[model samples]
Target: MEAVPLEHILLLGAVLFSLGILAVISKRHAVVVLMGIELIFNAANLNLVAFSRYDPSLLQGQMFSLFVIVVAAAEAAVALAIVLRVYQYFKTANLNEIVSPENK
Candidate 1:
C-alpha cells in the first residue's frame, strides 16, 4: 500500500472548499447556508490535518483545527438561533423573500 500524495489531499480540500462556496452563494435557505459553512469548516480541517501530518511533533495544525471546530459549533448555535428568530418574525426562511417589498 502506498501513501496518498499531499497534492491529492490538498486537491480534495480545494474541491470541498469550492463546493462550500458554491453552496453559500447559490442557496437561499438559512439551514442550507449553515450546512455550506460546515462544509467549508471541514475543508479547513482537512487542510490543517494534512499539514500537521508532515510535522507530527508540533501538532499545531491539529490543535488549530480543534479550535476551529469549537468556534464553528458556537457559530452554528448562534446563527441558528438568529435564523429561528428571523423566521419567527418574518414567517419565511427564504432569504430573498425576507428582503422583499415589505422590508423596503
Candidate 2:
C-alpha cells in the first residue's frame, strides 16, 4: 500500500550506472563491455520510470524509456554482430588483443 521513495530508486540507478562504468573500464572482453553498456542503459531507464511515477500529468518519461529500451536492444544486436565479426577475424574477443598493432 505504500510507495517506495524516489531517492531510493535514484540511488539504485546510480549504483548500477557506476558499476557499468567500472565494468566497461576494467574488462578486456568485448562482450563484457557490451553488457556494461546495457547496464548503463537500464540505469537510465530506471531513472526515467521513477520520475514518471512521481509526475501524473504526462507519461513522457515512460514513453521515452520505451524508446530507449528499443534503441538499446537494437544497439545490442548490432554491437554483438560487430563483436562476432571481430572475433571471427581476429580469433579472440579480448578488446586489447583485437586492437593491438602486433595482431595486424
Candidate 3:
C-alpha cells in the first residue's frame, strides 16, 4: 500500500487554517468565532500528527498534539462559559455589539 504524502496533509491543514481565519473574520456571533479557533487548533494538531508519522524518531510531536488538544478543550470550555455570561448580561451574542465600559 502506498503511504499518504506529507504534502497533502500539510495542504489540508493550510486549508483548514484559512477557513478558520475566514470564519473568525466574517462571523458576528461569539460562538462561531470560538468554533473557528477550535478549527485552527485542530489543524495544528493534524499537522503535528502528520509530521510524527513522517519522522519515526520524533514521537514528541504526537504527544505534544495530544496536549494541545487537551488545552484547546479546556480553553473552549472556559470560552463558552464566558460567552454565556456575556449573553446573560448583553442579551445578544453579536461580537460587534459587545462593547464593555472599558472599551469606552
Candidate 4:
C-alpha cells in the first residue's frame, strides 16, 4: 500500500480537532460532549499514527496510540454507565437541569 503524506494526515487531524471543539462548545447534551471528546481523541490518534509512519526509528507513538484507543474505550464505557445512572435518577439528560446538591 502506498503511504499517504504526513501533511494530509495533519490537515485531517486539524479539521477533526476543530470540529470536535465546536461540538463540545455548541452542544448542551452530555452524550454530545462525550462524542466530541471521542472525536478529539481520534484526531490525536491520527496525528500519532502519522508521525509513527514518517519516523521509522521507533514504534513508540504507534504503541501509545493503541493504549489511547483502549483507554478511550474504557472511558466511553464508564461515561455511558454514569450517564445511564444519572438518567435513571433524574428522569432527564438535559445538561442544564442536571445539577448536584452542592451546585444547587
Give candidate 4's error at residue 82 in angstroms: 0.4
Model 3 residue runs over 4 Å out of place are 101-104
lDDT digits (tens) for residues 1-104 of candidate 3: 99989899999999999999999999999999999999999899999999888689779889999999999999999999999999999889999998887885
The deviation in Å at residue 42 for candidate 4 is 0.2
What tens digits encode model 2's per-residue C-alpha lDDT throughout 1-104?
Answer: 99999999999999999999999999999999999999999999999999998788999999999999999999999999999999888899998876656756
- Collision count for each candidate, in order: 0, 0, 0, 0
lDDT for each of the candidates? 0.93, 0.94, 0.93, 0.92
Residue-by-residue lDDT tens digits, candidate 4, 1-104: 98788889999999999999998999888899899999999999999988887688899889999999999999999999999999998787778889886886
Candidate 4, residue 11: CA error in Å?
0.7
List residue ranges in candidate 1 displaced over 4 A: 100-104
The C-alpha local distance difference test score for the whole of candidate 4 amounts to: 0.92
Worst 10 residues of 2 by lDDT: 95-104
Q: Which candidate leads the pack in lDDT?
A: 2
Q: Which stretches of model 4 miss by more than 4 angstroms?
A: 102-104
Better of 1 and 3 by TM-score: 3
Poorest 10 consecutive residues of model 4 by lDDT?
A: 92-101
Q: Could you tell me the lDDT of residue 5 within candidate 1?
A: 91
Model 4 TM-score, all chains together? 0.90
Q: 37, model 4: CA deviation in Å?
A: 0.3
The TM-scores, one per candidate, come to 0.91, 0.94, 0.92, 0.90
- In model 1, state the lDDT of residue 67: 100
